[model samples]
Target: MNVAVKAPVSTLIQQAAGRIAPNWPLDKLIAVNPYWQMRQLSMHEVAVNLSWLGGVHVYGDVSHYQHVSDDDLAQALSALGHELTVAQFKQQPLKQPQPWQNVAQLADLERDSEREISWNDEVVHQISQFAGDYFASQPQTGAGCDDFYAAWLDTICHDHGLEILMKSKGLVEQFKALPSDATTLVEQALTMLGVTDEAQVDYLHALLLSINGWASYSAYVGWQAMLAGKQNNVVEQLLAVRLAWELVLWQQLSSSELQINWKRQLAHSNQLKGEHQAYVDGLQVWHLANEMQIQQGLHQQLRTPLPAKDNAALSLQAVFCIDTRSEVMRRALEAQSPSIQTKGFAGFFGLPIAYAVGSYQRPQLPGLLAPQLEVREASSGKLATAQYSAQWQKFAKSSAGGFSLVESTGLLYLGGLVKNTLGLGKAKVTEFGPLTLSKQGKALPLSEQADMAAGILGSMGFTDEFADTVLLLGHGSQCQNNPHEAGLDCGACGGQTGEVNVRLLCQLLNDAAVREALIERGIHIPDATTFVPGLHNTTTDEVIVLSGQVPEQIEQWLAGATEQASSERAKLSASPDAKQKARDWSQTRPEWGLANNACFIVADRKRSQHLNLGGRSFLHDYNWANDKDFALLTTILTAPMLVTNWINMQYNASVTDPLKYGAGNKTLHNVVGGNIGVFEGNGGDLRIGLPLQSVHDGQKYMHTPTRLNVYVDAPKHAIRNIIDAHDNVRWLIDNDWLYLYQLRDDGICRYHQGYWHPVQ
Candidate 1:
């Protein structure tokens, strides 16, 4: 390849690699919008692009449209002001595919059709296995290599098994002729494939989508690097490796006739880039109609006029995460007594911090933001003993000792297995202690603590009111033998329990010096006011007090609240005993983690407090009056709202296209590389997103595939200003990734093209 042509090829490679969104690993797993990077394009464009590139669907199948009542479709069309009739819309073509197969896929279709093994499958398997070893939690024996591409090249060149497995005699020879560096390899591959400049991006992207799970995992490495103010080319390198595979296949299987077919396919792919307008338009209209119907139901729920402001002094005020699951607890808690009030805030409670235990550290805030503060565990002999025991357990489970240990301890493990199988074993809670603001061997100043306390208080709209005992309840879920346990935890806390952040915040708020500093800053904390930390166990709807001494009255209120909330949740769950579900090792559907979440309301809780949202809406308590200049509102829209949209879209995409977006059958999931991701039935591209069991219960889908409907209580102008200022935010709203609505005293108004239109 000529050096002059390398620049554009590299640019194309970079652009192609940008299409893959990051997939956080199992331990710190968080929901990510698979199309997040492509937000710059309209949702319709993405649907068309993905359809042609990978045969992926971006909306519900044609059956969904057929099943939806004609009246609902007509009303949805009317709501969106579309002129298309239900019959005409139904007649519109279903998702179409273009003849745009890559070299590996083409080879598999033409040359390897008679073979027992597919060339494409072999390529994905090889790459996925290499990725697993290269990024393994514990380094594999032969997985060592500094550069991603270089290691792959070295591994493939030496691996004689690949030639035998692929059943191609010249495969290793073709690989051996490849260039040393990723940039050079990519350039050469494009030149040999005769991929035109117009089609290079799409071609590269298609190659990546073939192994999307690993591509997404590599993108996560790059995402984390970028977050830390650095750049990582792992995604580009992985793209090059994928492209190289195509080049190898092209070399081994190409014929004069096949060469012409390849050229035609590339050209056709370029020509078909924007050719699905009719189908895409129909999808948009249908999706909007479905969303409108859901919105109408929510509107009815919020139709009751807001009750007159309650001035009665409260015995206690409890704050919970704005997560959809928290809505049930908050509602039930308030129902315990009129005097008891509840508020919702982001799960991490506005603390940008990471939690550290000995040698291990992880973020305790949303994935959108990097941790600025570090909270380290205080020295304790009990913690030391726990860490030592954990290390021994880790050693026993390692590849080297696992078989021997299992053989020796087979009888010893029987009792525990029986207990777990019978739902008698208690969930093991990791014990760690007294947290301090210490980063890199130094304790942070008291002023830093005071600053954090004041900022969170202000953002949470706690500037004016104070309760004698305010319980800050963070949430987590309990389940046995679940690799995706973190998925059930607080996403805003970076897929960890909110216990660390909430406990740390309570300590700061209770500090005498922090209180003195707050008073000086014009925010008053009543001396009698005590901040208590608690954990809301979503699995059982029980509140576990972590540190503070709760008032007798407040304890009684929490007991009543938990019982009522558990009863409400039991109706939706398979088993009435929530505790048994948590303990059951075979319980694939443990409490439906954020399954039906479709709406996010950023307004005072009073706006929808009386309505039973059925644990579907994420309620972030916001009082626009307290937020002068709309700074807090801007943060809410840009950060928390964006996070919720990611969560919503993760579910939406999983439900819409589970094969491409969701991790397959939980029963077949084999955890890849310890924590990177899972592989269904041992070998495939690493699975990402929620497993099928997370959103489906065998017969029916538990989650409705609705795009997020965000209801914000703010001036239309303020919402417009925020949207105008942020290009990504504008893309999400205007492109219909999610529906945005302005909550008003009169009625809810939907946002479209910089204007707000009132709902009927």
Candidate 2:
């Protein structure tokens, strides 16, 4: 339930400022108030100021807020070029303050009541006891993916608040005191208790922080109870926190009400936790087994229709394939398989084939390569089909699940992903896909692929319905060659024979191993992709094929789309050019300006029922678009919240507030392109571009809060600076940096190969 506490705009700031002062890093405070207008401000302005106020200093520089409001403070900062006149402020003189006026103040004034001190000692003791118990109950084993539980033990401990409750406060303080030391306070404490090694210590410390965040939420719940003059249910509160935490962790978005379905959550926990734990354990064991296999040199026969030696001697023609589908898959395949060969009749976007393998299977002999096959789509008056070769009858099958190398009819093969020969020298990675299994020689089970795919799908905000749609779309066995007409040519694999294997390349995106490699190598992943598919009416071509050389903004759109979808709210896709504009802001920090274009007032489809509630059109005209012909983009951001209620009808209703979560931030970057696209800057050229709603360079609270340091490496159309062309830059920004680990210049960031790492 949302506590609808409103406050005088200024009052909210004052209260939050006061309450946050003692706990916040001074540097952060200063940075947040860079404009430092002491006079009047609007409610929207207040929201912008407070959005990241909590998580900034914890991860970023904490010394940004040292000075209080003062004349000298303004002058000293003006050296950096900032205006501080009260005339810059705007107030709507809405006769009186809103009803929830002073709620933050109330919390600030009643701080003591909010801080439940009664269970402090008890909570600490219980935590310590649980920690001891957790450590003591160990070394148990189970078959089939339930053996190794050590890897995630810290996560479990932290989730239960048993890892750091006893000494979290003191540990954080000690770390603060010894800021120069590479070792954390938790490390020192554990070392004293005879535990050393950096990885283990890091793990333990992370465990503490994880628990500390939860403990803080627990305390907040208690405070809320005190404010309400009644005891709140712990189960409900904890469940809410769990659901909310999951949302921020996975979806990177929040809804208005922010309520979750408890029944669903409970069911999910019961179904997933234990099974997931077992999978992790099994993975560890599998890894160990795979190592043994590699050491012994292992191999597996590809399933064929015929017996052993029958197809052995045939001159086999192998055509290397590349799958340049998704960023992640493309990168992964490229990184995993990088062997070189000829470019055959592969389509513009499909895998690059060296040559079409001709089919001819024989008994007690290998299949012979007849001739390269030329595959073409059937159009009007074109040959629809062909017949098999008579030589293929020479091969027969074995009942023990045997395999066969069959000779296919000439030109039975289709087009694949091949690059022009000219771009080889500029390619970053040449291969992808783990053709060779891991040292453990373990293959990802098909069953596990479904689960893993689901996880990935969830990350992209695919509803059950949406996922089904995608599956159905891809169900046909016949592969189609999808061309990327967006002028995105592959430089790395642009030659007659593509140099970079796009299939392997896509998998390297955000692959743990790839990320580790990049981090170790110290290369930055360029945030770039092709387009952002909107919520509704996203073209099948747009959904699958990203045309044009990969643009940074398109990548951001992909990541943003996935993040938003996870949250279960619909978002319209920004144009490819609009995405580029957002990417441009990454070049420099943002300045305060009216961002009219950035904020879009999209009609909420979920709440269309409430609009014109009294009319027949309310029920009849439920479609988001009224049959108007305009490019449509749609996406559901934020994950579904599992909820339950005593009232069965209300139980499954989504917890949503269109005014909050559905509301778009109208900052300079967003509004500049859509509305006023002119701003006077220090440079000689007048800055005319799309404005971003909020400062894109500021800290993003996604994934534990980190500063988004966008570097304008190189822009094709050179201006003095990226921020100058506000109109052009509006459509150039990349919001998918989180998804890209490797930056490939050939307009493709293939996954599974190698990816780039973000700067810490």
Candidate 3:
């Protein structure tokens, strides 16, 4: 193949590199859009780009062009109407998307489909496994870690991953000769590809895209770069090493049949242009338009006359994460206990603590933020059996113990598995610490603790007014054998349950010294007020109370609250099968994890209290009157609000293009390298985002794909200032990935082209 360079082909690689973000391992899974870096481009453009370059189908299934039901096809045709005439419409289901599978699937459909090239899947698997190990080889935190790339470069050079994989194939010498530094590595990779100058940037971007997840992880850690002005060296090094690895692999494949014509593929990709890109873009608009119409109806229906300036003092107040799943419970609990008001905030509750779970330190903050404080777990009182804990940990971590222990332990173990599998046994639950123990560490400084309390109160709109009994309600999901269990956990708490955050914050607020300092900070809590902690089992749709030493006057309220929650939930759920579903070992649809999320409203509870949001909106309570300087507004826009947009996009991509965006068919998924990641079937690339069952049910899709509709009740200038301050946010809004709405006393105004227009 006498392949010359394709076009100038100079800028694509760098452009793509800028767009990729990382996917965390399954244990610490956070919702992410796999095509996140490509968000700046139109869906059709991204779809076409991947198809030409990697033989990936971004808009449709690669297994085949997604099959549209006859009903869906009819509807589409009807929508097209005169544009696509009935007589000329030959639906007849487009031909088999491809005649071949696997390695040969890389052949471009629109280009030369006749030439089939063989790809070695086994070698690809081995390489991918090694890549997983390489990333995990270093300490979660390390010495001289100022630069991730610099640290990563050191790790790769010193590690045996590359050497081990190459030695058996007789490429150890060639691998060792590869440049160890990122700069020299990039230069060599570009030279190998016959690309130079600006094209080197394009080539580098393409190489990173080949293993985009790792590239994203480095960039993902440099998250503040999205808002900050500094460059992220770690991201640069990550991309460089990725390019270097591919270069070494390419050299090894040079003499094998597995070698692909690099220059030809690049040339072929560049030469291609989509004839129906505009049409595809147009077709995608209705889904977004439909979402807009639905949300507006709820906005109007849910709208209510504004409440009195001072919120009414309540018998009880509970705070929950602003997750869409929490929307239902908050609404239900309020109805069940009229005097018991409920508020929504981030699950982490402003305390970014790294929790001690066994021997590991898990960050209980959102993935976008780094952990700041470490909270250790200790066995005490009734839970003081450290010996039992050690034994349990060993059994849980050991694969042989998990299987053979049950086989040989006794009839009790053998019979238990059968009963559980048959769903006849009682449901098992994961229990945590008694949470009754408090740290005896030197009392945190009064100023720091007081400041934390004040911030929490101000952020949740709870200054001055205090309920008799306040509950900090944390939520988590329970399911058997689900690798993505962490995905269903609270995002604000890293990927763990919100229990620790709730318990710790409650203990901090309840401290007498903390209260004294909080008064000085101008946030007054009545002496009669006490904070209680509890959990809402989302999978079972049940509420469990873990009330500690609060004032003993809340016995009646607790009883009434639990009963009403159950009754209200029963009213909403069908057949009350949540518990059954939770217990089912192989159950796929484990409580509709963020399936229908659509709108995000950050305003006073009164603004959206009347409308039944159908668990589609993430509601965060904020009063514009209290936020005088826009500090609170800025934090909301940059953090919780931004996180909701991520959740929305992950669901959006999974539904719109499941095969390309989602980890298809959980049953076929094989977990790779312990908790590193999962590969679909045997091997290819590491899968990112939610699995298919998480998005689609067995019948039709449960989630409707839509860009996040953000409704912020604030002055237009305040919202505009926040937008102007962040370049990354502007990229999302200006590029049309999300819609921003500002609530004015007059009406709702939609933002477009740097201006606001009345929505109505």
Candidate 4:
């Protein structure tokens, strides 16, 4: 197919490929904003583009708006300065389709009656299967093939089953004759489709969106490469593969009349802009109103003045991650005794390090940053038993002995399965001894350790006035037979438990030499003060001391807090026993896992300690007065705020459009390529985002589909300065991806486009 191309096809291909957001694998599953690449565009503009390109819903449907009370809707619209009536808005029609449809979709519409399978489904299935094999953790057949497109082509050319499934006899021959290069294939496809210059990017993007699952995974590869200061073109290759399939279908089904009609439709669609303005505008109103209603409730809670600080401190202070789940625990712990002060910070505790266990090294930091240091077990005695068990499992799964081993152990497996079913099986625990922190395989110097300690304390505003004992509690969830368990773990720890980072931080803060170095710098720790490391099991609401001796009073406080928090959590779950919920293999909603998350408050705990946020707000303790130059505030906004936005958007997207953006039914999920992602059934695109059960209860949605409302206790000018300095922060705010509020002495104010207004 030697078709002449007129547009900058390569540039368009790259531009289209860049639209796909990265999907981290199951092992390090982090919530990603699906429209992150389109942040420069306004939400309304994105709504139009996504609708036109992929029929994606950027906001809630009209039915979702019914939940909002008429009075609330009126108040919300008034707050936004919109005059649309509730009746009129409710009557608005749904978004209509654009004429620009992918060729694969057209092929499916015109599929032969005899063929039960659709071309679109077959294409997605074939590509998904090939991608699963290509991107497998352990490479299957195409180990040496570095180019994804070339590998897929090479594999498809010999696969006779695809030809039969696609019901095309010469498909293999056609694949064998296709261009070997991605760019060439893309150019040829564009030229053949007669896609105009204005429509090329949209057409290419639509093609990628058809197989968005693999494209997202490919984008993750590019994201990691970019993080390492390198370049990757796997997304572009995936786009080319998608285009090739379109080319194949077009050639087989091409007709003079059909070609003319398709060209006309493409040009017409390109020309017809704002065709769904009414629908989009109505949706925007509803979206804004919903967010406003939530914002108002949050404001009501945070409006109270902070109480006077208590100078008399005894017992201990506990610091926890700013995760929404931690709010309940922190609130409960403080309610136990007035002597205990709980603060919130990022779970990694300001340590950018990776933890090495056995032969595998996992980064124990946020996904936004790479590991700067390493921590490993100080003793190997506890690891031997774990390693031996792992080796035995590996041997049992090996091809050489798999069947025989399974046959010999079949009865034992059955017994274990029965025990698990009856909830009699005990949870497995892999213990680690003391940890040693290092940089470049060498011990970190005392000065560097002190610098890290100072940075942690300074950023978290923990300078001055130390308690007799300070507990650093990191959190992790416990769930059995869940492939998406990492999603429930600490995202700040790159989807792993916060054990290593907290324990390592404790070691640094407790070091005598490091403390001496810190004293030389300006910060001082009392000789009587001690640092303790603990793990907050989010599933069971138990705080387990990992090391050192916590005082008896502090222990009692934790026990009381656990009892209260567990009781509160039990009301939300199906079963009253939290431990059984963690062990039950069939328990779909082990814990809500940050569902209903709506607001993030960056202020003193005292501002919100009195009011219950219903476990929906991410609380970070920050005192702007303590932070000079706004550096700490900048870090909080840039890192933790952005991470929370990603989480909020992931939930929003999953709720607004569950099938396209969410992993479908959890019961139907089949783990693909050993944790790459899940397939709803045997074959389809790899499902990304939370499952339906995560966001939806059996009867109704659990997560409110509202953008995150971030309330920062900083000066408006300081917040604006940070936003002005960072393009991403500016984009997120200016484009309405999230709402930023400034906490002032008078009241909370909203920030919009370099201006602030009393949040009505």
lDDT by residue (tens digit), candidate 2, 512-578:
5443444334333333211111111011112222112223433444344334322221121222222
| Candidate 4 structure, TM-score to reference | 0.94
- Alpha-carbon error at 239 in model 4, in Å? 0.4
Error of 2 at 548 (Å): 16
Using lDDT as the measure, the top candidate is 1
CA RMSD (A), model 2: 29.0
Candidate 2 residue 729 C-alpha distance from true site, Å: 40
How would you encode candidate 1's per-residue C-alpha lDDT over 1-760 as one tens digit per residue? 2123544667888899999999998878999999999998888789888877887778876555444668888887786578978888777676664536877766665654665588778888999999898888433111223399998899999998877776768789888999998998988888877777766788888888889898988888877877777667888989989999888887887776667777777656546655655555567677766776787799888778888877879789889999999999998999877888899999999988888766577899898888887887677778778768867664443333334555778967656646866767776564446788865567877777777788899888788788999999899997766778889999999999999888888888888988998888788999899998899999999998888588888889899998999999888866799977876656788879899898999998889988899999999989998898999999999998899989998998898888889999988888777678899998989999999999988878888878898999999999999999998789999987888998888888999877778888
- Between 1 and 4, whose lDDT is larger? 1
Q: Candidate 3 — worst ten consecutive residues by lDDT sum?
A: 95-104
Cα-based lDDT for every prediction = 0.83, 0.21, 0.64, 0.82
Question: What is residue 263's positional error in candidate 1, in angstroms?
Answer: 2.1
Local accuracy of candidate 3 as per-residue lDDT tens digits, 578-685: 666675556766677788788888888777766668778898988888897999988988898778878988887677656545778888777655565677886776
Model 4, 421-471: lDDT tens per residue? 577777555344677888998988878888889999887777787898999
Instruction: Tell me the RMSD of model 4 versus the true structure.
Output: 3.1
